[model samples]
Target: MRSVFHGWWVVAAAFAVTFVGFGAAYTFSALFAPLQLEFAASRASVSAVFSIAGFLYFALGVVSGPLSDRWGARRLIVGGMIVLAAGLALAAAARSLTQVYVAYGLGVGLGVGLAYAPALGAVQRWFVARRGLASGLAVSGIGVGTLVLPPLAAALAQSVGWRGAYLVLAVLALVVGGGMALLVESDPARRGLTPDGAPPPASAPPPRGVALGEAVRTRRFAGLYAGCLVCGFGVFTPFAHLVPYALDHGIAPTRAALLLALIGAGSTAGRFLLGGLADRLGRLPALLSMFVGMAAAMGLWAAASDFAALAAFALAYGVFYGGWVALLPAVVADYFGGRAVSSIIGVLYTSVAFGTLVGPIAAGRAYDAAGSYLVPIVLAALANLAAAAIVAVTARAPTSSR
Candidate 1:
């Protein structure tokens, strides 16, 4: 069997499953209203579920990365699919708010933690030269999921009840995600090719491994970690709140849903387009540009009152956000080398998990206290500005050569 051919196919397949799984998670903003109405829950409380899930996913990144290094990405991802399906099924049957929290927040979160970051690490192992684009393409699954799933869930919730809708999603995730996980192999070297698709040097020995603790102590690892933290704080707030805020502004619910989808659609375009660019422009420049675009998008979102403006913001933001997702990990690999990319990237993602955990709660509280979404929007815009600065400072790191 040709490992390289099968290897790329596995990477692409993993990307597709992850895109849907993460996208379903991103679509929570669209579900926020219905959930609130159904449970009569406060936005703060409901938003906490996402935070909890994100925290688990990120915190576990610390462990999952090391574990994948010891075990493999295939087991983690497959186990995650099973757990994810089970979590959703349990969530669909949840009667109280606490049950939802346990099922979706903790249970589904466990599945997410297992699957998402490991896939990135796995893809990194397969391609060295194209790692940035490969990672982006893999992560961009969230964008594709965001674009498709939320509306489908929303429409399903409208007719079938939110519980039933969740049940459907649970089944869909299980079959597709499980099948893909079964197909995923951990590395190309297992089949005898070197990283970047070139033939291995005749003298090269088999790949050596790095310890997780050693990986984090390095300066490059610390810089990437900080940059991802700032990026998470800014990136999640918009996706989490945009739909509710749009409805508050008197936009029809369906249209607001469409706007959210547009953001995902924009993200999809950005990932594919920018993945290639990161292959050429260097990861730092590509990432810095994405943060700048995110800052601008937040500013535009702050001022937006109509569909046209929101649409423009989504398209523009999606492109850069998509690009950033694609390139940042590859940048780290360039500095640290791919030998322990997953563990290194996993430590960096701990910061990202922190940002995602905090972003929505802070934004939700800001809206509740201020009685408008403006404060949160402005704050998010400023957060993006800060992210840009972090990326700028860190851009001093090596772009391609390790």
Candidate 2:
């Protein structure tokens, strides 16, 4: 509880954790082929491993969020880092498919779930006036990590064995996540302020908190949740499948790798630019624009045949998608109230987990059936368009205390 003037430093720490932790998780796409060959597994079986990891990462967030609210961010994040490191290290030595699934799907999934909620929740507590910008800066670490890790992972897999890559990743996770945990704490109670930076009155009792059920029952809560679901589903397509799709399209592996890297770069820019903009345009408009822009980016990906077009699509899409992730949690807090923001946001985030589970599996299945990425990319574009439509139509109105 040191009195730091700039709470944004906390956000920067959160970003660093997310950049390494979640970034490594999303980079699994680059690991799929290596894993499949490593274990002599079929594509379907290999895909299931990552899908399970995605599901656990997302589904567990529902509980992790509430737990963070109850337990505080520091313990949860440190614990998650330990679990993530252990899981990755174990996976490096895994022999059976079941071992791999348990190491990755259970350990990594739970670790991410534990870490992600608290990271955002801590950042949410630290700022109010510039909530959008703060959240963007913190979450944009995922973008930075995504850009940096996947290609690095691909290279690691090529040079060192995949097992060695996992060992290196585990070490990276421990170093980054552990260091960031030192900077993370819970609410500003130690600093004598509510989330909005207002000093609590000397004699006034604390305000009543909202229950989870009551929060969910509100109209605004439902709207925000639906909007986030669409946000989750729409932006993930290009992210999850882009690397493989590029290689399939006869692009050089290095160029395909760069395309994914551009996405990470775009996401970092988007989180800052769009998030800062949200503080001005109002959060709802910012989110709505993200959905629309993401839909367009997905379409661009489906249509692009060359490196330039694909790179442009990644740049444009990554920016909006990154902003959407950063802003939505803050938006959840704004519309629903902050008392249960972590839990509410966690539940809302399940849609992304669901999308992550479905996107790669569905895309891979479609590719298997059709013998091409064309149909799957088109379908992903259509899904994004539909998500944009849903966001456009969802009602937004402020709700009073429940």
Candidate 3:
């Protein structure tokens, strides 16, 4: 009897890793109001907590990517989970917003930063033909986490208080994320198999492609970097602000929080359905559609007011957002090959880091000043359209060397 391929196990582990890490990180939506009330802070200030954490998690990918290449992904993933758990635990004890920033922002940011890229990159090394499917399945954890965790955290906060909720999440991060991290192996070669479980040829060369330096020098990388950076400005706006936006419209808190779950639901569908579809449709084209789709979704958000309309916007936005997350790494692998893929992916994500750092806080400040999310929502929509233009231009350019 044939044993199941080990790559699938790696994918499962990556899924769990992302689920725990991102679930915990994204639970900030549930914590946002509580923290704001507790700290007596302004909207932008509270939003900065998430922005800071988001920035670290994405930006740290540059360091974590290279480290994963040199030291293997498993250790970094395990260590990151531990750090994340500690950060959450410390956040539970915070007496001030600054402490919360130091505890949650630095902790969750660093933890996800350590684990996310390495885990995502490890999956890339294990499949070629089904890379899109596997990558989608692995990252669908984020969508799923986004669906499940925020509501759970909101419930926990109701029962146990927000600080206690943080503590509970910390334990979950340590146990679930850390245990799964153990299963993450860096490459298929270690298991005496090849990508997609093909029978190994007698003399397969090591994974070959351009080095990170050369890859970064290419026009393709520049286009991807620029597009992602621009897209980043709008990509995370909804995650941090959607609940508040819903609340301002007189939605009940519980139902408002569930709107994020709607996003998670849409995101999950997109990753699973669109991911497989991209393999058939051409990933680059599918990717361009995602940007366009998101642009339209943001436009819907700008016009939405009632629960039904907002829910529609959430689902649409999430679908495209999920596809964008699922496709970027796969697209990077497609163009650049496996060599230095993790490192290249890490550097590319810095564009997202800068955007994440600014986008949400800017939205919050816009809302505070204008007493409406209109300007930011409209801007976010335009940003996605700009990203679509950049990606379309990239599609016309020649492919980079492997």
Candidate 4:
């Protein structure tokens, strides 16, 4: 009888790590209103808390990715979970919004930054043929976390208050996130197997691909980076403000929180279904579709006035967003190969870091100035469309030599 492949175990572990890290990070939406009420801060100032955290988590990947390449993913992931827990605990004790920015922003941001790229890099090394499916499955944790955590945070906030809610989440990060981090391994070669679990040929060479410096110099890389950076300008707006948007339309708090859940649900399905579909449909074209789909969904959001329309927008947006997230690492792996993948991915994500930092805060400021989200939503849609054009042009370029 054949033993089950260990690569799948890595996928499961990656799933849990992402679930805890992103779930905790995303719970900011649930905490948003309370923090505003507690701090007497402006919308832009409050949103900056998440923006700072988002920027750190994504931007820090540049350092963490190279470190993970040198130190192994497990160590980085475990350390990250600890840092995340500590950040949350500190945020629980914060007396002012500035403290929250330091504690939660740095803590959650640094924590996720350390773990995310390494986990993704580890998963990329474990498979070749099913890279898209595996990548999709691994990142679907973000969707699931988004689906489950915000509502849980909202409920806990109602019962125990936001500080107590942060405390509980901190404990969860230490126990669950740290525990799973143990199972991640950077390379299948250590276990005498090749990618996709085939026994290594005795003469087989180590995984081969472009180094980070060389990879970064390619036109393909430039297009991918530019596209992601442009999209970043609008990509994270909903994650930070969707609940507030729903509430502004007179939706109940619980129901409003569930809107994020709807995105998660749609995202989960997209990662699972569209990921497999991309393997058959061609990954680059599928990636292009995601940008187009997100642009269309953002249009729906701009026009939505009621619960039904908002829910539709959430589900639609979630599907493409989920697919976009799932496909990126796989596409990176496909274009560049496994060597220096973590480092390359980390660098690529800096685009997202800048966008994450600016997008939510800009949306908040726009809302504050105009008393509505219309301008930002429309801009976000346009940004996605621009991203689609970039991706389309890049797809026509030759793939990088493996």
Candidate 5:
């Protein structure tokens, strides 16, 4: 009888953790209108909550990354769950927008940052050959969370109001998240297994690669950093504004929520399909394809007006964006090796953080200032095209030897 590979267990755990964490973090968009109405805040002001939380998420991941390599992800993830729950609990009970900022923005954002990179990095350690597939499966939880949670959140909000919906998420974070933590091990070596469930031949280099500090000195790192920054920025604009953009165009609130679900739906498919593609086509080719698709999709996004148009945008955005997320950590492994996967990926993620930081807030401010979403949407389309071009150029650059 063959025992199941423990690496799969790590993937399963990562899936659960990302589902709850990203689902909760992204719930802000679903909750956005309600929060805005309740607080009597402007769109930019309301968006500040998610923006602040997103910044903290990226910044904290920088620290959590190296720590994941040393300490394992179990403790860090468990701690993240506790923080996430507390943030939700605090946000649920809050009487003022300021309190919501501290609870949801600072608390939840910080917790998610701590959990995300570490969880993904741990998976990188588990599989070498199937790296793309494993990451895609684990991160599909993020897309599913986005897809399922918003509609569910809308339903919950209808039944119990937004507060109850948050309470539900908080409880889920505590229980499901805690159980998942027990299954996480930073390295399969702790269980005496090599990557991809077999020993490498003596001639193969060890999966562990150069230290992050040294990896940063290479041309490859700079290209990856700059490209990811643009990718992150272009990707986040819609997540922050899509719901409101829909509502502003006279879509019902319930229908507005569906746009996010559509994106999530696209993301789920993209994660698995593109992940498989990366493995088969080579990471660079797969990445190039997704970036090109996203560039075209963002053009679709800018022109979206009707439900049909918006739905098209969601599906297109989801597929390309989700694939890009799944491919990245594996790409890092292709470059830097597995030993410091989290640390290296963490730094790259800060570019993602930079995207989340400026994209959402800037889009929000642009909408507020211009009294229209058209500017931001068009800008996002251009940014995506730029990112695709940059990544293509980087693809041609020489690989790092470090």
Candidate 6:
């Protein structure tokens, strides 16, 4: 048997870290009900925890991406694992809403922020030729993690309580995530091999990087950023609120949590399947398809008064939303080149942060005032539709819009 390439090991590390990091974060949806009961907090207010954590998660990428280039992914990931475990432990022990905010918002946010970019960036550096497949395969863990974690979390909440579940997650993060960190190589140079195990090209120097300043000024970047902002709003708000939303519709808690699992299952497929389509059809088209799908899913969610409709929403949203996540690295790599793919992705992801930060808070407010998710859900679908239009127009034409 041929020895597994070290690059695949790096992919393995990326997968494990993502599974733990994202799985823990996604549990916030299931955590919402318990937190509301304990804290007597309103939906919008309790959701601030997720909003703040997500904000810090995306915002800190600016620092972590550059640091990953200077230091190494392994160091960042190891450090992040420590921080993540501590944050989960801290959040678990909190007595008040403020403590929850500090622990999950700042602590968890900072830890996840530090790790995510470096992990994905390192994988991108390792697989130049198979960039899409490697990234999709690696990020598939996010979907799998999303799929498996929520139901287990719901079960734990019902049995041991949410705090115990959190402590268990803290242990899992430290053990599984930290051990995997050892296997990651921040750059392929450390393995004495070029990216994708390719031989060094003759005579030509490596391509120069696109400066962040130059990249932001481009029409393409502007459009992509705008689209991400909208997509983030549409996708993440539902992620944070889906379980509770289903519960509001009179669904059983476990079955409501299964809605999130369906998203994860569909996403796992999307990351791999649509990721390959991005290689063939172009990243913009793949993104367009998924964005449109997410918009329609949201519309279905708005009308969903029954289990079947909600389940359909979960499955559709999971596939498209997962496709969006998987395609991002390839899109950034293709547009910006690998010179600073992580940094570019990190910057582009600020739009995602913008979406995540605003979406849940806004949705919460809508829920609080109107006692229904109809407004925001419809708005989310509109945002996604607009995102699709933005990508189609800007990518096809050189100008900002058609």
Per residue, candidate 3 scores C-alpha lDDT tens digits across 84-164 of: 999999999999999999999999999999999999899999988899999999999999989999999999988998999
Q: Clashing residue pairs in candidate 2, if any? A: 19-141
* Residues 1-402, model 5: lDDT tens digits: 148888999999998998888878877888889999899998888888988888888878789998987888889999998999999989999999999999999888988888988999999998988999999999998899889888888889889999999899999888987689788998776677888889645464455688888877777777778877887765777777889988988999899999999988999999988897788889867876777778788889778888999999999989998888899888888888886889998888888788887888888888889888777777777776777677667665555544
How many residue pairs clash in all the candidates, one count each?
Answer: 4, 1, 0, 0, 0, 0
lDDT tens digits by residue: candidate 4, 1-402: 249788888899899988889999888887889999999998899999999989998898899999999989999999999999999999999999999999999999999999999999999999988889999999999999899989999999999999999999999899999998899999888888899988789787967888898888887888999999999989989989998898899999999988988998899899999988999889989999999999999999999989999999999999999999999999999888899999999999999999999999999999999999999999999999999898788765765533
How do all models score by TM-score?
Answer: 0.94, 0.92, 0.98, 0.98, 0.96, 0.95
Q: Model 1: clashing residue pairs?
A: 19-141, 19-142, 23-146, 136-326
Give each model's whole-structure lDDT.
Answer: 0.77, 0.77, 0.90, 0.92, 0.85, 0.83
Better of 3 and 6 by lDDT: 3
Off by over 4 Å in 1: 1-4, 206-211, 397-402
Q: After superposition, how far is residue 239 of candidate 3 from its true place, in Å?
A: 0.9
Top candidate on lDDT is: 4
Worst ten in a row by lDDT for model 4: 393-402
* lDDT over C-alpha atoms for residue 356 of model 2: 72
Report how far residue 31 has shifted in candidate 1, in Å: 1.4
Candidate 3: which stretches are off by over 4 Å? 399-402
Better structure of 1 and 4 per lDDT: 4
For model 6, the superposed segments whose C-alpha errors exceed 4 Å read 202-204, 396-402
lDDT of 2 at 65: 90
Candidate 6 has an lDDT of 0.83
Which stretches of candidate 5 lie above 4 Å from their native place?
A: 199-207, 396-402
**Candidate 2 residue-wise lDDT at 326:** 82
Q: After superposition, how far is residue 45 of candidate 2 from its true place, in Å?
A: 3.1
